[model samples]
Structures are given as C-alpha cells and as structure tokens.
Target: MWDTEHNNGVLIYLLVPEHAIEIVADRGLARCVAPGEWQALVSQLAVHLREGRYEEGLAQAVDAVSARQAAHFPRRGAGTAYANELPDAPAVR
Candidate 1:
C-alpha cells in the first residue's frame, strides 16, 4: 500500500479461516475517511462473504474504495495517464 505516490492505497484483507475482513488504508486516506465509514464498508463486505458471494463482495469492495480514493486524490487531466501503483494479484501470507 505504501507503494503509491499519493499514499492512498487500500488493502482489503479477508481472513477466510475466521470469516473476517480488514480494511487497511494508507495514512493519507485514513486522515480523510472516518473509522466508522470504514467499518460500515467492512460490514457490507462481511454480509456478502457470509452469503458465499465472494466475487461480488470483492468487486464491490474495490469499487467502494476506488470511489473514496478518487474523492480525496482525483485523477490527472484527460491527457495524463497514471499507472497502477499496486499489483492486481492478491498476496497470501
């Protein structure tokens, strides 16, 4: 998450064994978003996971986070393109 230039990276960690979800946001985003807001997002994702909608839950989570990120750090002008700072593949450890 620290790899991003704007320090707005977000990591949605799902602990399958315990049926838990953790939203980790970089300091830049953490400062802009409230803790309760993040918890609400987590709760929504939890409901989807409990219903066995893993793919949909993950997609929704990504969209939610992306929206928040955009609110804080908007994209450059139309002529400018930015590369993704984080990898698309999830890291399992």
Candidate 2:
C-alpha cells in the first residue's frame, strides 16, 4: 500500500475458508473514501461469493476499487503513463 506513488493502493483480501473479505487502503485513499462505501463494496462482493461466484466477485471488487482510485487520483495528463506498482494477478495461498 505504501509502495504506490500516489499513496492510493488498495488490497482486497479474501479468506475463502472463513468466507470473509477485507479491504485495505493507503492513507491517502482511505481519507477520501468513507467507511460505508467500503462496507457497501464488501457486502456486494460477499453476496457474489456466497453464490459461489468467486471470479466474478473478485473482478467486480477490482473494478470498483479501480474506479475509486481513478476518481481520487487521476492521471496528470492524457499522454502520461504510470507504472503499475503492484502485481496484476492476485496471490492465493
């Protein structure tokens, strides 16, 4: 989370065995987002997971988080390119 340049990194962790989800955001992003918004996203993801839609749920969660990040930390210019600081794929253990 602290590795991102904009300090807006987010991690969505899913505990499959416990059917639990956790969303961690960096300080910059956390201050801009309300707790209820995070809870709402988690609730939506939980619904999809409970229905056995793991991939769909995860994809939606990623999209939602991306949208939030974009809204809070937009690119500086239309032609500007930013490096992806985090891995694109999720690491499952």
Candidate 3:
C-alpha cells in the first residue's frame, strides 16, 4: 500500500510478533528490481534481527533500499529534479 511519486515506492514490513518481514514495491519499481534482490534484504534484516540489532537492522534496510531506488530512479537536478512524495518516517501500523 506504500507508493509515491513516479509510482516508485517500497515498504518493508517487519512483523515483530510473527518474526517475519514483508517487502512491497510498486509496479514501477517492481519491474525494475528483481525479487531476489528484495529477498536478500529481507534475509539480511532477519540476520540482524536474530542478533537483536533492531536499530541496526532498520538502518541497514533503509540504506539498502535507497541504493536500489537510486539505481532505478536516480536523482536528476534542476531540469528533472525529484521531490520526495512520501513521508521519510517509517509507518508502524
């Protein structure tokens, strides 16, 4: 349900109770990124979480997602500038 400008947005749901994670990417980004790539991030998160590194895991996830996003929808200044369409803070509910 998380999507933004250029239809490029991703949401990583960390289900603490169920001890699982869900990665959701919009159609625009979905076509650009491989599912395996997303899986690897999820797996990485799990590993960090398993070691009780909640903050570190979340931080890594953000960095990883940013790298992937930069690849597909790079920042173009002035002429084709980018405006963040979604909130920077993570959604909990």
Candidate 4:
C-alpha cells in the first residue's frame, strides 16, 4: 500500500503484517517518513485488516497515492489513444 501527499508525489509503501504494519515513504528519490505518519497509516491499516478487506484497503491506498501523483505530475492529453480505431475516440479526444 502507498499513501502520497504533496506535489512532489511522495510514495509511501506499506507492508501489512499480522501483528504490525510496516510503512516507508519515498519522496521522489528521497525518503521522508515521520513516526506520526507511520502510526496513522498503521492505524488505518489495522482498521482495514479488522474489516477483512485488505485488498480493498490496498486499492484505496494505491488510489490515494495515484491521486497525489496525478496532481503533481499533471499528465496532459494522456487519456485514451489518439487513433480512430479506439472506440469513441472522438469523444475521448
């Protein structure tokens, strides 16, 4: 699982374990994870685990990270393919 915050697209990798969860945040090429954030992430993870929806939780976390990345990276015209072969290509463009 990964949680990202800020423009630089910080990526936080989470390792969910039975007893405890491990989290590591990567800021671009650097690492800048705080203890508090780790704790909060762990708490969220625990909730997910207890709910018996680890995959859903992981998907949510990944989406969070992707949202942050998109906000920071801001890909332009990166939606669908440009070729007319694509269904509803005009609509996409």
Candidate 5:
C-alpha cells in the first residue's frame, strides 16, 4: 500500500475460524467511503459467512467494494489496465 502511486488501497481481511472480518482502506479510498458503509458491508458479509456461503460471501464482498472504488476513483481512460499490485491468491499467516 505504501508503494502504490495512486494512494488508493483496500483490504478485506477475514479470520473464518474466529468469525471476524476487517475492512481496511488507505487514506485516498477512506476519504470517500464512510465507516457506516463499511459496518453495513461487514454485517452482510457476516450473515453470508454464518450461512456457510464462503464463496458467495467473498464474491459479494469483493463486488461491493469494487463498486465503491469504481465510483470514487474511476480510471482516467477507457481500457487502461491497472497492474495487479497485490496477489490475487489468498495468503495465510
């Protein structure tokens, strides 16, 4: 996140066994999205997790966050590819 030029970054951290979710956003993205929105997203994500819909919940969470990002920090030009700064695969500690 510190190395990114755009100053916009978001992370959705999940601890499935603990039933915990953390939505983290860098300063640029945080400026536009409200904490209430994050709270609501987390609540909805929790419901999906409790229902054993892991794939669905994750997809929904990504989609929801992506939509917000798109609205706030849209790309300047059409068809401009954004480099994958972070790995797409899940990482475990």
Candidate 6:
C-alpha cells in the first residue's frame, strides 16, 4: 500500500501455509523519505545488483526507481531520455 499521507500503520496478515501471523509493524519505515536519500538507496541497490544479491538489488531498485519519474523514464534501449542516461556507452569489459 502506497501511503502518501505518511501515516503510521501496521499491516497484519495470516500465513496459511506457515500457520503463523505476520505483522509488519511500521516503526521507521512509515516515515517520509527524501528524494536524494531515495536516490542513494537506488545506488546501493544497483551495487547490490552488481554484486549478485538479487533480493537486496530488487528491494533497492523498487524503492529507488519507483517514483513519479519512473513512468516517464524509459526502462532501457534508447537514445536519451533523462539527463542521467549518457549518450555514449561506457567502455565494456
């Protein structure tokens, strides 16, 4: 659930197969995150992706890139869209 209002709330759910109750208590996570901070999170996620830590990479990617700009921004294979995307390709190993 995307809570733009930044309200603190917990999501409680029951796991049938595990036969347990899952409680995601929002203590720190519910707080509003800044854009730069979020960008840093994305950078970290890319690092994680490079390191082959798939789960961490995915978490960081989703948290970082999942923004208003994501919709307008191209996923890949393009000629310039955002300023971040360089026109020239980097040297490949």
Per-model TM against the reference: 0.93, 0.94, 0.87, 0.47, 0.90, 0.30
List the lowest-lDDT window of 10 residues for candidate 1.
74-83
Candidate 5 lDDT? 0.85
lDDT of each: 0.91, 0.91, 0.86, 0.50, 0.85, 0.43
lDDT of 6 by residue, 1-93 (tens): 234222223333334355433333243343444446545654565576567686666554444444523433335666644343222222232
Worst 10 residues of 3 by lDDT: 1-10
The reply for model 4, stretches above 4 Å from the true place, is 1-18, 29-42, 77-93
- Poorly placed runs, candidate 3 (over 4 Å): 1-3, 78-81
lDDT tens string, model 5, 10-88?
Answer: 8899986787999888888888999999989999999999899989998999899889988998888989988877666
lDDT of 1 by residue, 20-93 (tens): 89999999999999999899999999999889998998899999999999899987888677788889898998
Model 6 stretches with alpha carbons more than 4 Å out: 3-31, 58-93
Per-candidate clashes come to 0, 0, 0, 0, 0, 0
How many clashing residue pairs, candidate 3?
0
Give the per-residue Cα lDDT of candidate 2 at 39.
Answer: 96
Using lDDT as the measure, name the better of candidate 5 and candidate 6: 5
- Which model is ahead, 2 or 3, in terms of TM-score? 2
- In the range 13-55, model 4's lDDT, one tens digit per residue, is 4444435555444554123334675566567766887899888
Number of the top-ranking candidate, with TM-score as the measure: 2
Comparing 1 and 3 by TM-score, which wins?
1
Q: How close is candidate 3 to the true structure, as a TM-score?
A: 0.87
Superposed by TM-score, candidate 4 places the C-alpha of residue 11 at a distance from the truth, in angstroms, of 6.3
| Model 5 poorest 10 in a row by lDDT | 1-10
